[model samples]
Target: MSHVHRDRKKLLTRVRRIGGQVAALERALQGEADCSDVLVQIAAAKGAMQALMIEVLKGHLNEHVVAGKTEAVRAREAEAIMQLLGRYAR
Candidate 1:
């Protein structure tokens, strides 16, 4: 629990950074950036988003969902998160 608490901050920070990057990308697009430039920003935003999910999912699995024998609960959480991640991954 203590360990889990510690790592959550980093995960949150990463996600917030990604959110900021997304906002920046939005602003860039609104400013009529070139097509290739917009695409580059979008690809970067997608990568950041993917990284955020990966960090959070791995943390949860390492700390909460996989630390005990709550098979049903872990399964539920894992399935839900993985489903959401699956869409993002594609």
Candidate 2:
């Protein structure tokens, strides 16, 4: 968990910036900014969100999921990972 603290912080910051980008997108739309510019902002927000998701998934796989020591625990980790993959895939 401590190992991921830095990554978590980075992800949090990314998310916060994405939120700002969303607000900017709204303003751009109302201000009649160029369509391309508004779409670029939207795409940036989506990329930030996807990056955050990847960070979380990597943390899980590298920590709790891989650190499992027992068959049952490993199985549960696999299940958790499967569920996460499903969500992310969609």
What does candidate 2's lDDT look like per residue over 40-80, in tens digits? 98998888888878877787776766777777887898898
In angstroms, how far off is 64's CA in candidate 2? 1.6
Ten-residue stretch with the least lDDT total in model 2 = 1-10
Q: lDDT of model 1 at residue 65? A: 69
| Candidate 1 error regions (>4 Å) | 2-4, 70-90
- Give per-candidate clash totals: 0, 0
Candidate that would win on lDDT: 2
lDDT by residue for model 1 over 2-82, one digit each (tens)?
444778788778878888888888988899888888888889888887787677667777766677469888888778777
Q: After superposition, how far is residue 3 of candidate 1 from its true place, in Å?
A: 6.8
